[model samples]
Target chain A: MGETRLMKGNEAIAEAAIRAGCDAYFGYPITPQSEIIEYLASQEPHKRTGMVLLQAESELGAINMVYGAAGTGKKAMTSSSSPGISLMQEGLSYMAGSELPCLVVNIVRGGPGLGTIQPSQADYFQATKGGGHGDYKLIVLAPASVQEMSDFVPLAFDLAFKYRNPVMILSDGVIGQMMEKVELFDQMPRATEFDQTWVTTGKTADRERNIHSSLDLDPARFEKHNHHLQEKYKKIIENEVRFEKIQCDDADYVLVAYGSSSRICQKTQKLAREKGIKAGLLRPITLFPFPYEEIEKLANHVKGFLAVELSAGQMVEDVELAVGKKTRIEFYGRIGGMIPTPTEILTVLEEKYLGG
Target chain B: MNEEIIIAGFGGQGILSMGSILSYSGIIENREVSWMPSYGPEMRGGTANVTVILSSERISSPIINTYDTAILLNQQSLDKFENSVRPGGLLLYDTNGITRHPERTDISIYQVEAAAEAGKMASTKTFNMIVLGAYLKIKPLVKFENVITGLKKTLPERHHHLIPLNEEGLKRGMEIVKEVQLG
Candidate 1:
C-alpha cells in the first residue's frame, strides 16, 4: 500500500523509527545491529524529522538516556545486541519500575557471554521471563520478517505508550541482516502530546507537580504499585496475544516457534506435508503475551507439538506447560550460532514424536 | 519459477550487491524476494557470500541449506557451494581466480570469464554485472530491460555515469557465457 523497496531489516527499522515520529534514539554500535544506528545516523533524522540520534558512550548510558527521555513523555528508543543488552539490564529494570513507555530492540546473537555474532534465539527466556530483576515484563514483539521489522516499530511504540510500559522488538541477527521487499508506511509529523497523566512534561500552576521515581521506601506502597503493574500485565496478556497458525486445521502435529525459528518452521511444515506428514506451524508474534492458549487449543487435537527454536529448548518449557501431560511436547534446537536446516528439524520431529 | 540462488566470492567482488540486484529486480517485477549475506566472522579474512531467493509466492525462509543456483567467483566459493546447488540446477562460475574447477556432475555447470569481460570494459567493478548478465542469460528470471532499471535503482547517483560501461560488460558476458556441462 506504500512505497515498496528492497531494504535490510535493520535499515527498515531505522527508517520506520523516523516515520513513527520517534523523538530520540540513544544507542551504541553492536554487531548485526550497528546498521540500525548507522542507518539512523545516515538519514540525519535530526534535520529531517527533528528526531535525535546519539551514539552513547555505552549501552548503559544509552538505556538510561531512554529512561530519562521516556520520563519526559518523549518517544524514545535504543537498540543493541546480546552483550550490550545485558549491560542495559539495570536501566531497563529502573524504567519498568518507574512506569515509563519506550522501545528497546534486541537483535539477538549467540551468547552466554561474548558469543559469536551469528543469529540465535537464546534470549527468549531473558526477554519474556524478565531480563531485569523483577516481576516486570517488557511487551516483547518478535518480528519474523523484514516487513515486520519495519511494522513492529510503530506497533511497539503504540503499545509502549498505551500501557505505559516498555516494549521490545526481539529479533535476531538473521532477520536484522537479511534484506527483503518491504512496503514502508508514510511519514508522520512529530508532536509531543502531553495528554498522558503520568508523564512529567513540566511543572505548571494549573497542574500538581508529578513525581517520577521508581524508589518507594514504604513496602505497602511498593506492593500496591506492583499490584497495579500486574493488573496491567493481565490486561496485556488478555488483549495482545498475536500469533499465526499455518495449516493447523488438519494437522496431526504442530510446530510452535517464534521469530526467525518460525520462518524456518514454515518451510519445515511444507517439507513435512510433502512427505505425507500433517505438520503445521504456530508462530507467535508477541513473545511476552505468547500464544499459550493457542498452543493449548492446538494440543487438544494435535497429537504432538514440536518446540523449535535457536536455543536449547528455552521456549519449549512454555510449550510443555501449554500442552500439559495430555500431549507429547518435543524440543529441537541448535545453539552457539549454528542453525538447523528445515530437514534437520523435520527429522528431529519425526524421530522424537513419530518414532521414525 | 522460484529461484533460490547463492552468490559467493571474496569481499569487494560484489557478491552481496549481485544478490541485491537480483532482489531489487524481483521487487520491480512484483515478485517475492529476499537477500541474506554472510555477516559472520568468516567474512573478516575469508570469502563473502549472499543467499538470494526470488519467488512468485511468499518466501518463507530467507536462509536455507540448498540453492537452485550458485554463481561462484573464486576457488573458495566453488569449493564451498559446488555441492550445495540442487541436482539439475545451475552452477555458474568465473574462470578468473578459480584454481580447481567444479567437479559436480549432478548440477548444470556453466562458465563465464567475468574478469576477462570486465577487463575489456577497463573496470573490475563491472565484474559482478558480468556474472549477473551471464546468470540472467541462462535463466532470464528477470527481463533484461528490468535489469537495466534495477541497475539504475541499485547504483548510487555518483556511480550513474558508469552504467553504460556496466551495460557493455553485461552484453559481453551474455555473449561469452558457455555451457560447460549438463546435469
Candidate 2:
C-alpha cells in the first residue's frame, strides 16, 4: 500500500524477512550475496524486536541454527551464494528429513567452484533436481525483480509452513546486486499459531515432547516416513507449480528461461517483433514443481524453443524433457561473470526462427 | 506509461540520489516502481549505479539492458553505455564531465552543464536534481506538481530545510532544459 523506495536487492530481502516476522537470521558472508548478512549485522536484530541475527562461523553452522530455531516453530531463514549454499546442503537435507519449515535464499553466482563474482543460473539443476542429497525437494522461488524480492518473503513463509517444508528463494548476482525501488509493507506481527501438536517448544505442561534425527533402525518406520514425505512432495507438485508467459498467445517460438536470464529473453521478445518473428517467453517463477504442465502447453503452440541462460544449457535439459523432442530446442550462454547481452540473444532468435 | 532509467557515475557525483528522485517522482504519480542500486566495493570512488524501473504493468524482471532512457553523469558511464542504448532511446548526459560526443545517430542526446549549473546553485551534489529536472522536462512522464509532492513525501522528516533548495535545483534544471530545447 505504501510508495516504493530505492533499496538494494540484498538489503530489501533482509528488511522483508524482518517485516515478515522472521524470528531469527543465521548466515555467513559470501560474495555477491554477502550484503544480506551485512545488512542484518548492521540492524543488530537482537536489539530490535528480539530477532536473533547471528553471523555464524560457517554456512554449515548457520543452516543448523536455522534448523534449531525452526524446530521450535519460530520462523527463520539463512542465505548465501552458490558456494555457501553448497556447504549448507547437509543441514538442508537434515531439515527436510525432520520436516522443519524454514527459508533459504541462494543468490546464485557462476560456479563449479569459486567461479566468479558475476551472476549465473548454473544452479538450476542443483536447486531443482535436489541441491541436497536423499529423496527430497526444496520449494524454489526465482525472483527477477527487487519488488518481487520483497513480495516473495511472505509467500515463501506461507508455503514453507503450509507444507512443513523449506522454501528456497533462488536468485543470482544480478538480482542481488541490482538496485530498485521497493514498496515495503509494515512488519506484520509474528504468527505464533501453528500445529504445535508436532513441535518441541520445551514440552510445556501436558506432555513431554521429542525431536529426533532421521536415522531409524526399523526399515518399516523409515519407509513410512519416506512415503509420507513423498506424498507431501506429490501434493506440492500438484498444487504449487508456478510460471509466467508473455507474447506467447500466438507465437511460433517460445524462449524458456528464468531469473535474470528471463529478463534478457523479455527484451529478446521485443527485438524479435522488429525482425518479423513471432516469439514469446516462458519464465518459471518456481524452479521446483518445475511448472511442467505449463511448459507442456507452450510446447504444443511454439514450433521451436531455446533455453537461454548464463550457464551453458542447464535449464535446456528441463525444456527438452517438458517439450519432449517434438520441437528443436537449443541454448546460448556466457559463463564466469560474462553477462549475455540482448544483441547476443537476438542473434540466437535469428538463428532459430529466421533460419540464419 | 511510466519510464524507468538508470543514472550511473562515479560514487562522488551523486549517482545514487539521481536515480532516487526519478523513482520518487514515479511514486507520486501513483505508479509502481523499483530503484535497485549497486553500491559495494565500487562506492569508494569507483563506478556506481542504480536501475529504476517504473511500470504500469505488474513488473517481473527489474534488470534491463535495453533502456528506454538513460542519464550518464560521467565519461566512464557514457563510454560503457552510449553504444548499448536502444534506437530512439533518450540519452541525457553531463556536458561538464563528458567531453566526447556520442556518435550514435539513432537516439536524442540532451547534453546539460549539470555540474556547472549546480556549482552556481552552491552545491555540486544538486546537479543530480538538475539532470532529474531535465528528465521530467523531456519525458514529462510525471507532473511537476506530483514530483514536488513526491519530493516532500520522500525527504527525511528531519531535513525539511533542504526541501526548498532541492525545489530550486529542480526548477533550475527544468528552466535549463527549456532554454536548451528552444535554442
Candidate 3:
C-alpha cells in the first residue's frame, strides 16, 4: 500500500496483472483499451522478472496464446474491446470447453457493428449469457472506476485459477480513457499456490500426462464433462454476486444502473432529494451474477423502478426477471454512443412520481 | 460535500485553472476528487472538454456527459454544452465572446465580460481566474479559505514566487462576480 498516483484504467489493469504473478500477456491493440498494451510494452518484464509479453497478429491469435500459456499453469491474459472480443469468441468457447483457466478483458465500446469510440454496456448479454456457441459461462466482473480496473485484475486471476475457469474484467471506454489514482505492488516472489495437478508442464520423470482438445468420441463421457462444468457454474452463482446500494432504506422508486450510467444516478439521487423525491440507486459491480437478490429486496419497498443504461434495452431484461412484475418498472436509455443526461433521467422520474 | 467541475476553453484562455481550483478545493477539504484534461491531438487548438466527478461516496464513474454546473470560458464550449445543462442548471459564460444568451429557457445563464475584468487587472490571460471568481459568487460550492489553501498547495516548488499574484487574481475574480447577474 502506497500513495495513490493517477493512472488510466487500462494501465492499472496491466500493473495489477503483473502484481498478481501474471507472467504472460498476449493482446492486440484496440481503441479505449490500448493503454494496457502500451503500458506492458514500456515495461522491461523480460529483463527484470522473466514475464512474457507479446502482441499477436489478431485477437484470435492472442486468445490462443493465452490458451497455450494457461496450459502450462502460468497466469496469462489477453484484452480487447467489443468487436475484437467478438472475434475471440471461438477461442473462448474452446478454452471453456477444455476447462482452461485464464483472464480476458473487454473494455466495451458502442457495438453491434464497429460502433463508435464512445462507451456502451451493450455487450452485457454476450458477456453474461455466453456469446459463444455451446453451453458455457465465464465469470464476469464489471469495474465502475479506474481503481477497480487496477485492483480487480489480480482478483480476477485468483478466481480464474481457483475455479479452473475463465474470468473477464468487463470495462468500458470511460474507465479505459479516464485517469485516476491507483496503488501498485511488486510481483509475488513465489507463485503457483493454486492447484497445478491438472497442468501438463512437460512430462516428469515419474509420470506422463496429456492435455485434451474440446473433443470426445463417447457421448456419455462428454455429457458428464459438461455436467461437471455446470456444477462449477452453480457454485459460482451461489457464492459470488456483488452489488452496491445507496439510501435504499425505506425508499420508493429505486433506480438500477451500472458503469457510466451509475454516475448520473448518483447526481440524480442528490437532485431528487433536493426536489423532495425519495429515490435511490442500486449499482452492480459484478454484472454476470446479476445481483438478483438485491433487486428483489428493493422491490418490496419501492413503488416503481428505473433501469438506466447506455443501450436502449439490455440489462432491463435481467431486472424484469428479478422484480417479476410486482411493480411498475420502466427503462430510459440513449443508444448509438449518446449518453443520457441527468436532466432527462430526472424528467422521467418526475413524470412517474410527481406527475407532469 | 463540495462539487467538482471542469471549465474548458480555447488554448489562450485559462481553461485548465477552472478545473484546477475545483480539484484543489476538494483536496483542501479532505474530499476525494480529480481534474482530468483532454490532451494530445484534442488539446491542439481544437475543441477540448474535461470530466470531473466529486462525491462523499466512492465515485464509480468519472465521465461527465452533463455538468452539474458549468462555467464556459469561451463561445465554442458554450455552443457545445448549452443544451447539456440540466433544467434549472447554471451556465457561467464569458460575455466577451458570447453576445447572445443560450436558446434554452430551462437553464439560468450568467454571462460576464471575463476578459475585460482580467485585462483591467493587468492579468490579461487570467480570464479563468475571473470566471472562477464568478463561479464562487453564484455557486459557492467551496469556501474562500479552502480555495486559497488549495491554490497554495497547487503552487509548484519552483513557482512559489507567483503564489501571491495568483491569490490576487483569484480574489479579484471572485469580487468581479457581483457586478454581473441574470434574473
Candidate 4:
C-alpha cells in the first residue's frame, strides 16, 4: 500500500493521471465526471509535473487536441459523458486508422439522445463495435470500483501505446460519483526518452521525412492499411483479454456483467448461493477483448447464464455469441439512470431459469 | 460487522458531507468502505441521499435498494425510504418538521431534534452533525475519536476552527436522541 485515501472514482482517476506522469489532459465539464477536470485543475498539474490541463470549447475541440498531441507520441487523454464521447467518435476513428496512441474516458450516462444523467452500459456497442465509420476497434477497459478508476489510467495508457490505438475507459455514473478506499501509487517520472523514429518528432537531416495520415487515395493502399489494422486487433485479442471469475468452481448459474453491473451481480451471486442456486460472477475488466473463452468454458457446467447490465440489453448480445446454445441465457437490466437491485436480479434469475 | 447505512435529506442539509465524514472514519478504522450519493440533477429539488457501507469484508454492491439502517432527516425522505430499512434494523430520524413519522413495527425507531438543537447553538449547518452524533450514540459503529479524525479529514484546512463546535453538536446529539414508541 502506498498512501491510502477515500476518494470519489472521478477524482481518483485525475490524481492517478498525475501520478502516471500524463503529459496533458483536455476535456470539458460534465455532471458525474466534471470532478475529473476539477480535481486536475485544483492540483495544478502544470505546476507539479508540467502537465498541460485545458478546457477545450467543446468535446470536438478536446479530442482533436488529444489527436494532435498523440501524433508526436506524447501521452494524451480526454474524458466526457455519453454525448461528449459520441461527438469524439470521428476523432477516435482517425486515431485508430492512423495507428496513434491516446486514452479516452467515457463516464457513461443514460443516452440515445440527451438522455438522463444516470449511469448506463448502453455504450457497449459504440465502444467495442467501432462507433465511428470504417472497420476499427478501440481497447475498452470497464472499471467497476473507485479503486479500479485510479488503477486503470496507467494501464489504459500502457495498452494504448503498446497496441498503437486509442484506449477507452468505459465506466458509468455510479463508479464515477461513488467514494471508496484507494491506495494511490507513488509518482512515476514523466516519459522523456524516446526513439522518435516512426512517429513525427521532427524531420531532421539524418532521417527521411515520416508521413502520418489516415487518407490513402489509392483503394489498394487503403485496403492494405485495413489489413494491417485487422492484424493488430487480432494480436491484441489473442494477448489482451482480461476478466475475473468468482465462485465459478462450483457454479450452476453464471452471471456475466461488466463495470458497476458486475458489482451488483456479485451481490446477486451471494443471495442466489444462499438460496441454493449455485450462482457465480464473471466480470470482464476488458470490455472490448471480452471474456468469450471463459464464458464458453463455464457453459460446460452451468445450467444457464444471466447477463446483468444497466441497459435494456446490449452486452447480452455478446453473451449470446459466446455461449451460443450451449446453455440457456437470460438478460436483466434497468435503464435511464435506474440501477437494478440485487434482490430483483436474483428474483429474475429464479423466474427465468428455476421457475416451472 | 458490516454496516450498510443510508443518510437522506435535502441539499444544504450537510447530507453529502455527513456521508463523506462517516465513510472517511471507516478509512481511519482500516475497514473496507464505500459512499455512493444520489448525485444526479434529481437532488436539486427532492430528497438527496448517500449510501455508506463499512465492512470487515469486501463490499459487493454500492447501489443497493435496502439498507441495515436508514437515517432520514425530513418528511419527504421518510416517505421515500421508510420501507428501505431492513426488518429488525434501525430507523433513526429527526422529527423537526416531520408530519409523518416511520410506522414500521419490525424495526427500532429513534428520533432526534437536530434542527432545534443545532439552531440553539449556531446555524442549522450543524444539524446533520447532531443527527450523526445521535446515530453514533445508538450504534457506535465508528469510535468517537475516529469520527473526530473523520471530521478533520473531510473538512478542508480552512474549516479546522469549526471542529470543536461540530464536536459539541455531536455530544449534544448523543444526549438528546430519544427512542420512539410504536403503537
Write the candidate numbers in order of decreasing lDDT.
Answer: 4, 1, 2, 3
What ranking emerges by TM-score with the best candidate at the front?
4, 1, 2, 3
lDDT of 1 by residue, A104-166 (tens): 999999999999999999998888998899889999999999999999999998899888899
Reproduced native contacts, each prediction: 0.79, 0.37, 0.16, 0.91
Write candidate 3's Cα lDDT for B73-100 as tens digits.
Answer: 6677888788777777777777776755
DockQ for each candidate?
0.80, 0.32, 0.21, 0.89
Q: Which candidate number maximizes DockQ?
A: 4
| TM-scores for every predicted model | 0.97, 0.86, 0.80, 0.98
For model 4, residues A1-356, the per-residue Cα lDDT tens digits are 68999999999999999999899999999876999999999999999999999999999999999999898888899999999999999999999999888989999999889898888989999999999999999999999898899999999888888888999999989999999999999998778344446678888898888876889999998998899999999999999999999999899889999999999999999999998889999999998898889989999889999999888899999899899999999998899888898999999999999892
> Candidate 4 falls in which docking quality class?
high
- In candidate 1, stretches whose alpha carbon ends up further than 4 angstroms from where it belongs are A192-194, B41-43
**Quality of candidate 3's docking, in CAPRI categories?**
incorrect
Task: Residues B9-117, candidate 1: write the lDDT tens digits.
Answer: 8887888877887788888999999998888533475788999999999998777989999999889889988988999889999888777999888788899999887
Which portions of model 3 miss their true places by more than 4 Å?
A: A47-49, A183-190, B10-29, B35-46, B54-74, B82-183
Best by TM-score: 4
Clashes of 3: 2
Clash pairs (backbone) in predicted model 4: none
**Cα RMSD for candidate 3?**
5.1
